[model samples]
Target: MKAPYIFNIQKFSVHDGPGIRTTIFFKGCPIRCLWCHNPESQKYNQEVMLTSEGEEEIVGQHYTIEQIVKKVQSDQIFYDQSGGGVTFSGGEVMTQPIDYIVELASRIKRLGISLMIDTCGVAPVENYQKILPYADGFLYDLKFINSQDHFKYVGKDNSLVKDNLKFISDNGGAIYLRLILLKGINDSMDTMEKTVEWLKENNIKISEIDLLPYHDFGRDKYNRLGRKCTQNFEVPDEQHVLNIKYYLQQEGYNVKIGG
Candidate 1:
């Protein structure tokens, strides 16, 4: 496979996974999440955008697997010291070049560097199967239990997501569930109840659950990219977020507030 366009290489990211880690943010996503903070990650090709300060910027760069491995290799010491490694985030890492992802994962494992795929969970099951052995865990995002809501907000069918999640869990891959909470859309108690029911029904094994509340942090980026900044989603209140977390905790889940 040829080189792939990656949007960002964020170093020392603590929230993506365990410990301080380097995060590989690839360009291009399968879903168009309304509250996505990284608007630059939505497109596959390189493009120019105006920054907040009105500065012109070009996003996306082609990177070879060897160059990326070398970059992450520099952080090996940090990974060893802090239980931190590399997180392959996106755009949607799973939907990117599978050959690149598989090869990079193999190299990362060969180097003994821990690997995690922060995914939106909308890719083929075979993609998950390819990296199952190399990945330490997955940061799997579950946006909505309702198919309509998922398609309306996220712009795709979620059956594939659910199927892939179950596939990963059943295949013995560690799953760190990420729940995106949009007030009045998917942050209701009914949704939570059904979520618990779904998890129980499928027997999904989750190492942890991250409750990600809605935020308009990337609203301005839309304007910079010459796109609409639609504020269709509202941020879940503090107590509401806590309530969801509390309810999930009651359901015997290892739940946390953020990813």
Candidate 2:
């Protein structure tokens, strides 16, 4: 199989999964979320971005499965110590070829390493099915419950995302639902209620709901990539995050403020 484009391999990433993890950031994403922080990761092919010094710099490179697995294996000692593993993050790791992901995941599993796919859940059901056998679990994003709101903010309809989530649930896939709580974007009480309703209606049992507070940390990346930073949403305050967490707990759902 051809190698997949990758933008980054972040080591010692604590927030990507259970323990200290190595995050493999794949390139390309179908949905153009307005609040996306990794603008350099949105494209599949190699691209150039401006550096802080105002010099052009390349952003992506292709990596073979063997090469990636070897790199991840170097961190085996850490994984064994902390229950950490490798997290395939994005530009939607699902956008890569399913066969490639399956192969890489197989290798990781063979090495006794846990594998987690951080996805936007906007891919086809078959993609999920093909990857399910290899992945230990998923760090799935749930941006919006209402389709229109999702379209308005994410530049795509929520149908595929919702359907894929339901599919995962039906298949008894382990899921950690991540909701980016952006003030005035997707943090409305109504949205939260709808999400709770949908989960109950579908009988989806997630490990936990991680409420990621929206921040402008990626704003500089947009500028560096020469992309327009159109995000105008404010980051939710600490109290707001706590309130949402409390509300979700009240609804009988396990919730955490951050990953």
Candidate 3:
């Protein structure tokens, strides 16, 4: 397989996963979440961004598996010392060519580096199965449990996402749940309760649940790309975020404020 389209290669990202890591931000996503921070990565094709300096800059670039491996290998020392490795993030990493992803993952595994796929869990179960062997684990995003709320907020149903999560869990795949806390959007008591209930019902055992507070940091990117920011959700305060964390903890789940 050839190189896939990538919007960015972020190095020394402490939030993506364990230790210090290099995050490959793949271009394109299936769902249009209201609170997406990297809007530039949503489109599959290359796009031009108008910079503040009146210059047109391309948003996506392609890199072969070998090229990406080389870039990731550069951080070998850090990974060896810190237990960190390569993380394939998005737009939605699964949105890329599955063949290319599997090839890339295989190469990463061959290098003996930890591999983590940060996904929204919107892809098919087969896609997850293909790469599961190469991946050390998954950073699965759980937006909304209710189908109607999920579609209204993320423009997609939750059935596939739920099914994928269950499949991974049942197969003994390591999962770390990531939930974006949007104020008055997906932060209600009902949502939290349902999320806990769903996890329990599916018998999914996750290492940790990361509660990511919603932020408008991507608003500027939307403007630079000449795209409309349709969602105006507010970020949850520290107390509210802690409260939800506490709730999850009370339910016997290990929860953290941020990833």
Candidate 4:
């Protein structure tokens, strides 16, 4: 199998999963969101990005399962203490070759460390099937409850997203549902209502609901990468974000302000 290009192996990452984990960021994504923070990671190949000092820095590198496993093992003590482990994130890590992910995840779990898969949910369900056994949990993003809005901003049909999520849930995979709150975009009481209704209609069991307020941290990165940045998005109000949390909480869902 071809080795995957990982842009970064983020260590001590507390938000990606339960414990302090080394979140392996794979390079390449199929869908482009209007508010993507890591715009430089949208490509599959090793590429260049202009640094703060105006230098060209390569963005990706090849890594084998052994290399990543070793890196995760270095933090084994921390994982043992904090219940954190390894998270496979990406330019949609699920879009990478299935065999490679399966092997990588299998090897990582052999160390008795937990494994989390952060996905945009735009991939073949076969890929999820291949890795489900090894993945301890999934950080599944619910960008929009409606398919129309999903394609309007994300530029991809959300059918596959819902299908893959349903597949995982039916298979009894633990899931942490992540909701991206954009002020004038998807943050609304009506949207949240549809979200709850859909989850019930589909019988999708989510372990937790995480309300993520949109931030412009990646706007400069887009400029650095020489790409057009969408400037119309706004962060949801702090009180509104809390309101969303409370709303979901009222629906009998365990909701948190952030991931």
Candidate 5:
């Protein structure tokens, strides 16, 4: 009754969170960001992917909370060793049935394992409120500050996003703000300053700011779907990131590359 339209399950991912983790990538997103690396995750329905052998539909066996716990517990040895547990990524994790997210997160918390959610913060505050108690930390993504820029590039105005971030921060949500460094899109000093200003205005002390470099991983998928790929924008080199970091540091904010 509470099944989510899930797409992929990745095991042993280190880059997503602390130590080793199993990331559950759910399906469906409200905003279609041009630079999304996982374009396959944009749809709510299960999609078919071609493999060497044949076609593969992404729908798999659904696991209940207890069932999923077994798989997560199997990684307990790793969890104990690396301080990693599970991360709920998505199309948008909060976009799923709140009951499902709450049930799953509550179970994981009961296990004393660290649970994290990587969100675009486009969903309702009630959704965030439901999962906030269970989350040990949040990987909060902020793409653009200007409403029009956000609408053009990300396909949605960010007023709700801003409110959600403020809501979470005001309620004492432990968060690491994630900003993707796109060459011509969000890398300008004006955009960066606006982002910094938003953070400052919220009185949110950044635990860390992860500057993600845009890549072209989703180009082939877009091609396969018969859709024109648009996120092939240039990426900032290491030096460029360094300059941005210097600017953030000068503003009294600590910055880092990659979350």
Candidate 6:
């Protein structure tokens, strides 16, 4: 009878995984990445935001597992048709109690719906292992392979991220490594090369490397919250993104932008 605290649920989402999905955005995160697109999700507690309709709305709503499953199962026909399923996203879904994720995912899988998790991999190794079985695919975020650099930009070390990725790879699961290419940050040639080398060395064979060019999509959210905009947020140009794509391609890796 456990109910999770969820911030939002987006239906007909295509970018999260292999098919059209209903993405459940959970309400918490452990790290404070400066370039966060979903600032509302960063806080472990609920926060209110003003909608364009000029109404105040809280970020999270409590939902029982049965209730959410009912909503998701309503789209079972679409899930079957589009090869889509339920995707548990977040500030970081694993940040929630592991039992909740496991229970929800187990139910989703039982109904033959593909389950996915979009995570930054900052949680404990045991946490990652807990949900790995129920997920059909994972959009794994690899912000910075270099631990120090990771802590500086992402406000946490990269050890857990790396370790969880290695564990996922070892378990023969479907994992997509997402790299956010921020200008003057981790977008340098050395960082990219080193990251590529590190992944290969760890025996992690990602089917595709999604090079996400940094942008200021979250700036307005910060403004809405009356918070200061993150200074020096850099979005790389087309040439820069293309160059990184080519570099990874040359390394025999399939590369795409903004996956």
RMSD of each: 1.1, 1.1, 1.1, 0.9, 1.7, 1.6
lDDT of 5 by residue, 57-160 (tens): 45433567776777787887897799898999988999888998899898888888889899998999999999999997789988888789889988889998
Pick by TM-score: which candidate is best?
4
Which run of 10 residues does model 6 get worst, by summed lDDT? 223-232
In the range 115-205, model 6's lDDT, one tens digit per residue, is 9889999888887788888888789999987899889988889988988899988987788889988888788889988998898888997
Error of 4 at 249 (Å): 0.7
lDDT for 141 in candidate 3 is 94
Candidate 5 differs from the real structure by a C-alpha RMSD in angstroms, to one decimal, of 1.7
Clashing pairs in 3: none
Off by over 4 Å in 1: none
Model 1 TM-score on a 0 to 1 scale = 0.97
User: What is candidate 1's lDDT per residue for 1-259, written digit by digit as tens?
Assistant: 9556798999999989889899999999989887889889988789898978999989999888889999999989999999999999989888888988899999999999999999999888888999999999999999989999899888997899899999999999999999988888889999999988998999999999999887778778888999888666778899999999889899999989877
What digit string (tens of lDDT, one per residue) describes model 2 on residues 1-259?
8777888999999999889899999999988888888888888889998888999989888888888988999999999899999999989888788888888998899999999989999888898998888777899998988899888888999889988988988897899999999897788788888899998998888988999999877788888877789777888888878988999999987888778
The pairs that clash in candidate 1 are: none
* Per-prediction TM-score to the true structure, in the order listed: 0.97, 0.97, 0.97, 0.98, 0.94, 0.94
Model 5 whole-model lDDT (C-alpha atoms): 0.83
**Candidate 5 residue-pair clash tally:** 0
lDDT (10s digit) by residue, model 3, range 33-54: 9778888889999999988786
In model 1, where is the ten-residue run with the lowest total lDDT?
227-236
Query: Each candidate's lDDT (Cα)?
Result: 0.90, 0.89, 0.89, 0.90, 0.83, 0.85
Give candidate 6 misplaced runs (Cα > 4 Å). none
* Least accurate 10 contiguous residues by lDDT in model 2: 223-232
